[model samples]
Target: MATNRLLRTAGTVLTATALLLSGCSSGDSSPGAAASGQPTNGRTGSADTMPEAATATIKPLPTAVPAALRPYYGQKLTWRECGIVGFECTTMKAPLDYAKPSTATDLKLAVSRKKATGPGSRIGSLMVNPGGPGGSAIDYLQQYAPQPDAVRARYDMVAMDPRGVARSEPVTCLSSAQMDGYTRVDQTPDSDAEVDRLTSALRDFTRGCRARTGARLGHVSTAESARDMDVLRAVLGDDKLTYVGASYGTFLGATYAGLFPSRVGRLVLDGATDPSLPARTMNRDQTAGFNTAFTAFAKDCAKQRDCPLGTGSPEEAGRRLTALFKQLDARPAPTGSDRTLTESLATSGVTAAMYDEGAWPVLREYLAKAQKGDGSGLLALSDSYYERDPDGTYANQMFANPAVNCLDLPGAFSGPDEVRAALPAFRKASPVFGESFAWAALNCAYWPVKPTGEPHRITAEGAAPILVVGTTRDPATPYPWARALASQLSSATLLTYEGDGHTAYGRGSDCIDTTINTYLLEGTPPPPDKHCT
Candidate 1:
């Protein structure tokens, strides 16, 4: 029920996808190479130019450490067995405010790793982040333990929960009951009264964050988290950083490359986000991306015998779904509990399935049930999307999501007026999802803290060859964003996955897996024109 524009990873979505569909991986590794997969034509720059560009443009920091940061950069980390069978957990300290490194306040960040099971010599650490800006890298490591065998054979698999994420001192704000009410609030307002209610909700949400999070609210920007990562790299004893970042993590990785280009080893940015676009534009584009994904689902649903969307064309299917949403807006369907599936929650449930094609069947079943007045299935999907537990407690993600998003860039709109002004364009982008998303973008406008960062191109000119992987039908981070990020990074090689999903690396594409695996192992990037299905 947070802003729909958060470039979240497919961790929960993948889990739901796995339950409904077969052939899904456990988020750990991918199936082997697909012999039949082939590449399409189109080239950017020569892959051969990457090494030279990285070397020639490299601008490293001075050998002498800054006096203020030495303590953090030099501190030792104590790793101990925790979480699961194979993972080791540790904590590292970072200045609460990088600009005021001498301040007494500090943050203790959580980190986890699984040692390399090498038949070959160890090749340093390969850190991983699964987007969310709020996603717990430590949790991601635990869930996706034991990376691909080839990569695991060489590098130590590591993950550090960013400054204010799970395990770290997370940015907590809302209580479970408050969050339940927040999620059910109408996202698509009609009358001016409804608009006022939506604006008041955002204001209240911001007030809660300011009251609960305090001074740290202003310090949780993506740029600061990138700095934390560098200190982490230094303490881990890695001369250069090798990483795999997905969705919003790509932005984090790219920021690191831009800030410390000389220290980039081999970074794979999957489901890349474009740092050059303003917040509003990014939200608008994501609206269209979900529409593209939903269209695909509609087409697939039409082929089914009991398709709830009916045996109509994809366009017709969308119309039927849209009608259902409007009906829910007027009369929310009951979910057997005190809670009901309102238009906003119903829309969230449908959009959640757009993250991967595997959830299409589940969507069909839920849509059927919702039409028959049994909204429980759709409510469950909404719960999954929001990471809400049956006990009614919520994860810190929804809270941290807005905290980082609001501070990373200026809000998409300053007031409800701006959102109303942009509604036409949003609706044009996604006939079904656009208006709701347009209103969702207003959540950040009432932030108590002003943004510290802005839209700008990040050309990590001196970084080693970085891989930017994009899924053509990625619902969260659109395909064009990947292309845009790849183009922005001087040493990047774009790897295209002509598939349907939020990311490419471990989503069952042999061509994508093989190309990325080869790069992680041999330090060779896929050709700039590389495309796979």
Candidate 2:
């Protein structure tokens, strides 16, 4: 199978979820004025900005278990075949509130596993997540995860849908028709009236989420999900957890290590995120990352005869893309379907291509077609990015993406006023994406569930060695983030893939695959500062 999938904040629905964390968080609000995809001193921040980490130092988890939580700690799981031949599925319950476990509502989470195909003794359960804060870990495992035989032979590959994500109790907002209108709404507003319209739509979106999902929204923070990981680990009879996470999954894995450092076994965090940065900085850095990725794409495209952006320097290609966006903004292109190619959809399609270079040929094919006034190719790309079905129904990924992102960090900006002020920095970061991404950063501003999580450094102190992978020109999670995250963790080895794409693993570098596989199977980590071109 392919290494599989991921997205950033503000890019999901109308655009796509910036859950944009990997590419969406720092990858989400269109990265700000920073050196695009380059490393700064122990910080992957917007240009010269450094986001403030959470001030409240959470007390270390207690060694002794309390009575109310013991039921969760000791709960038994009933697993049954999920019809996937080898995989099994089950549901586990967690307290809605970790602080008040006995009084709060119980949460049911979905879990799936393909037990070790062992010729070797089984090590334990190896959990995986494909990032997106909203990406379906279970779905990723079923579809894309490259369960290298060596690792699969020694571990039960498992995946869980964190609370408020797919299969678990999901949070929802807009209906299909409502989402259609929302997606077409202008993201790059030029007038006060247009800005007002955008703000109103945002309010309505958040309001819909609040009205439909209720109190449960507040509890879906990454911290809570990390705790859930501990619960899952204990229930799986593993004293220590073995995990492979990419992009935002890195953040989730790091969070788990921070909360339960003693319970970590072998962990791989690919396309890592720097949790210490504030949402705004994350938005900006991600914007820069995309800029870098686009530069790469443009350079490559300029070589192809069918390249729509043309054979000039990458600078020229960027200009052409900018013009196309502006044109689409004024007059959306026609798709074969009823939907016209709005600027938002077009941007989403472009960003989707940034995730993987393998998609570039396809992007070129569509861009060539799009330049001729035919948007079927671009529209199809956008539809794929949004995961829109032929019936127009969307998978819950986009909806759940914001539900988690809004809860994970404070809003990048409180309102349009804040966003307008921040736009210069965003634009300065990437003249192409800065404005819309800046506005997109305002995604969580009206979240009904006040932010419970905050920018915080995760040391995962006293934990086993964790391997963090980064692709230098990765559109979503930049190389600097891998460096930043590695520095944050006390015991982490940095693995660098000097290449392009959203993530590095299982995307077919024998070097990357071998390095990661050796670590997973033999408890070995690549040389502390490993680099794979």
Candidate 3:
């Protein structure tokens, strides 16, 4: 099971939920900046000056490619039709340890692309990544890509699964059965024995990851993946990268821009994550974000008929939901299957629905069912969140999520005592989901690999204007992160969507879509103060 700090894309969550019903499935510290619907730090200059200023400010890449890295960068991609009709897939090579490059140490990475259906000149590849630190970029590209026809007509859409993620030498830990049990393990433990069991499960998970994944475990950091993206950029014949990254992908994109500022071209970071926060702060803030999202859901639910938590204030709704969680904790609810819905899974189910408001109605139904001693609906939602197929198998995302997160930064808490110490604040941030998210944040503490990166700001100086998009009530990445990231990047223009869900683009907002599509097509970012409802 991945930590609750997981930065998931809205489309991926909503899309997975759609399949499951059918039968399948941050950090900024600025006063008033995080919660505000409006952009915080405004970009200088008027709208007319924005386009030229953005294009002209970009720094040129060095003329020569590093001699040591040229072979990896210059290697040809032999694309073949990979089942999906219009999509082509290929494997690209990257040095496992960039510090030491050789054929013996090469790692094969999966790359996929759909060539432009053009009436206009090609505008290079529009690379995309849909968060997860572990979510498959190739899978996301297949499911949701080339969203705008005009943009698709002018650019080849491309995606590369980052190292240790889906299709790119994935990290696998638990078996299907192990994962099933792992997911059901009580995250919000009450007794000392339960706490020990939870900690034991985490230790075993980390051990399995270390035992199953060897040296490659140490090489899956976002920095390494960012470097791999540069190689992909060179191989694709693009002097600069034009890209869209959502959720954790925002962090990946920001890392790329920071690492290779001169090569950034028309980058879009929607549902932005703040790279400046430590693991603890990120997890805690995400807890608060979920609180904000659920409050929105509760308010909407209260106005509807047969609302599970009744038509009262959000606090009342939260209390009713909390009572349901307690009931499950004591006596697991039957889901018609052998796997009963424990409080942990129940929490995950509700948390999953909080990602996109489209799932709100479904959440209401599931909560109603759970109240009546039926947990199947909520279990399905949790299964979708974990990407567990009907066959009981699981995706590699859960494994890769921690592998990358633990390496990216230190653990949120070192031990159970620390978690207990921190629970008050976590609960204060989120009265309902806080305790579970707080304990979930402990997954990285047991990781075998020590962290290679730490909390820091990403300036991405001299990078061509990067659009930092945020949704006000975004559960995963939160709105304020967009503000913080925009302020950090020297050339970023903050675009706000005063709405619900994880991301703004393609989520029924013409304003958000037009602003992003225009920027990608014409390199003209919306004014920094732009906020759409």
Candidate 4:
């Protein structure tokens, strides 16, 4: 998951309250109110008053199964020509709406597997999810994940694109050109007119998605995606679902464990997000986490000889960077090409570089260029964050991002007035990030579909022990979220990676890699509170 600006300045209680209140309008009810089926004080419509349904019950295993079930369930999938060597691709069908299971809406899920290459006994499929809620797991598998020998040796490595994401039924909202317009919309609204413009952009974005893809939009909730995973598990014939999830994928994995506790096996959640937090709180914590990561970057940049910012101290470096952002905000910088980099793009570029230490040097170089009035490097970083291609085409991240995130949790703020009231608090939490991110929270405010779930604990009481990995200086999923989630789960072991970057496993920490690999291969959970430097 990329660092979202909306969550960076969510620490103010008054702002959160105002945002909540603004959600309740006499003429219009926000999706959060409607989907929650909670009462809105000002709204008279019954749409917001629907009774909460009983939690979906998982059925007992059937004694007799059909012949078709045999091949998928407990059958070893043979690897064949899947474009990539040693990898095979297969499709599994899941109900589009879990609530209407008997209905005939089959969502196709793309699955990939690389057979175990070890002399030891082969474990079942070990699934992986890179956090995006919108991130392509198959891309992650083919690119970064499968190279890990220790993991591939013992288990058949697998990755599936969740429904409405890539390789699955992709949910697209804007065309490439429209997306460019949307991305360029000023995120930092300084005046009432600017706030209205921001809101209009958000509403227009949501409306565009609804217009482009209406039927599939409402069905992309996390709960529905979790059910799809269970279907994948059954088709793969794994008695238990062994998996690894990072960032937002942790929430997906944890939800799966919660929904089907009896079927969980050797699950590992890295850079975990706490499922028990409200959107506002989660946003605030993430804001602080990014600031923490920025401080770390500043410290390192100060030591570099080519550092664009002054080398006196990290704080001084941060001040210089902040001043640079403000300068860009006032007068955007020109790239060699026709494109110019705005403050939002510059901030996004900086945020993208914060994801991995490997990118820090590149970021410093870009900062130096930007300081010299060249914006190409920073623009390139922002383009990567947006997943924009050379042809100006985009992956479905921006569109599918809100489709999944809004459904997973309610919005943080509801209106411009609320945002204005919360500005002071947001500014205090993240002076560098507050305005842009606090406005980013508005993305969900105009979502066409309402959220289907709320923040909740996922104990999965009877499930096997699950390993939760947290990076000490992770910019996306804060370490404390990992701690909070581990504490919430009944059978969870917290593994701490005292390091930088978004996730821990396979990122160079021998302690983290070895521990997670052993557990995946041998079914032994890492020791509780195990710290890896």
Question: Per-residue lDDT of 279-345 in model 2, one digit per residue for the tens?
Answer: 7777788889989988999999988888988899888898898998898898889998788998888
For each candidate, the alpha-carbon lDDT, in order, equals 0.75, 0.75, 0.77, 0.69
Number of backbone-clashing residue pairs for each candidate, in the order shown: 0, 34, 1, 4
Candidate 1 per-residue lDDT over residues 1-533, each given as its tens digit:
25432222232335111100000000000011011011111111221111111111112334456798899999999989998898898889998876567546988889988898888999999999887767777777777532588888898899998866778888988889998988888988889998888888778888999998898887776767877888988999999999998878888888788768889999988888877665677777788888899889888898899799888887899899999999999999999998999998898788777887777788888899999998988888888777787898987877777788777665667677777778888888889888888888777778888665555567776789999988898878889988988887899999999989778877788888999999988999976669999
Tens-digit lDDT string for candidate 4 (104-177): 56677788888898977787788888767677788778766623676677788888888888889898888898
lDDT, candidate 1, at 463: 80
- Which residue runs does candidate 4 get wrong by more than 4 Å? 1-80, 102-104
**CA shift at 362, candidate 3, in angstroms?**
0.7
Order of models, best lDDT first: 3, 2, 1, 4
| Model 1 C-alpha lDDT versus the unseen true structure | 0.75
Residue 255 C-alpha lDDT in model 4: 76
Which prediction has the highest lDDT against the true structure?
Answer: 3
Best model per TM-score:
2
What's the alpha carbon RMSD for model 4? 7.4
